[model samples]
Target: MLDATIASLSELGYSRTSTTEIVRRAGVSRGAQVHHYPTKAELVAAAITHLFHEQANDVANRLETMSDEELDTLDGIDLLWGALGGPTYRAALALAAASITDEELKPVVTKLLREFDETLVTNFGKYFNFNGEFESFWPIGLRFAFSTLSSAALYRELGLEDRAEEIVTVLKAMTSMTIKQMGKNSRQFGIQS
Candidate 1:
């Protein structure tokens, strides 16, 4: 049933997905689905939760082989930007798009955004060991990365694809400059090129 929900959500937006569609796609009786999910809301929520877990797992897998290392804000930007530009990010965005019309699913999008922003800031401050302190740059760096990545996603939607690398490069440079200025504002941490 959960698998069915993810499939349907991936195919259709959250709002367009119904219990019937999921059960139909899953080849399960409505009774079986109801027995587990009880409500469409619950089922979709589960699908998103699954998506989140899967994404985290993928990140862990990617990091698993790397040497123990900290990721700075720019590194976080690169890591996250690269990840989201991949298939997982694609599916997650599609799900959230469909869910936008659904009040209950709004939290899923909010959760993803909150996690993205907070993780970028926290990991950057602690790991990646970027020199500049978080005070001057965390907020701006986060917002800039978010906006740039969101635009990169939009670029794909607009059929102007193949520019993710270029876009990410420019964003990295911009983020780096922001951090450079941050050095003057803070002595907490700073990463030198």
Candidate 2:
């Protein structure tokens, strides 16, 4: 039910969504929703938390099961791109954009990003070495992920196929290089242990 609400947020955006719509889509009574979440903010917070946790789990599982040959050939940027450029990814973005200016929704979105970063550190950073943790890795990593997707999605939104491809190419190269350098640094520092 909450998942239904979160999924709707991508299409409806934050300011537009209401408990009435969520209950309508979820096919549940107001009493059911109220039983779970007394306020709209609480519902949105849980939905954001759910998506962040789900994506983190998905990435962690992928990282864990993958072998060396897979990681060697795998494009980490694609993993990020696939997530951010997709419908579900944009939902988080839409929520974030709305949350920034609206104090009412700030905590939910802020915590969602924190959890996302925490997941990244717990999963990907386990294989890397960094000086100030998120200060170093997130700038070259998650921030890059967000910027790259914003460009790609914007190009596609504008119907510029050629420009989008070139932008993606450059971003992918930078991402690959960062991953490679981090791997080397991780090994040098024995971060795995």
Best by TM-score: 2
Off by over 4 Å in 1: 68-75, 123-126, 130-132, 184-192
Model 2: residues >4 Å from true position, as ranges?
127-142, 154-162, 175-193
| Model 1 C-alpha lDDT per residue in residues 53-84, reported as the tens digit of each score | 67655555554444444434455666666566
Cα RMSD, model 1: 3.7
What lDDT score is found at residue 127 in candidate 1?
Answer: 43
| TM-score for each candidate, following the candidate numbering | 0.73, 0.76
TM-score of 2: 0.76
Give lDDT for model 1.
0.66
What is candidate 1's TM-score against the reference?
A: 0.73
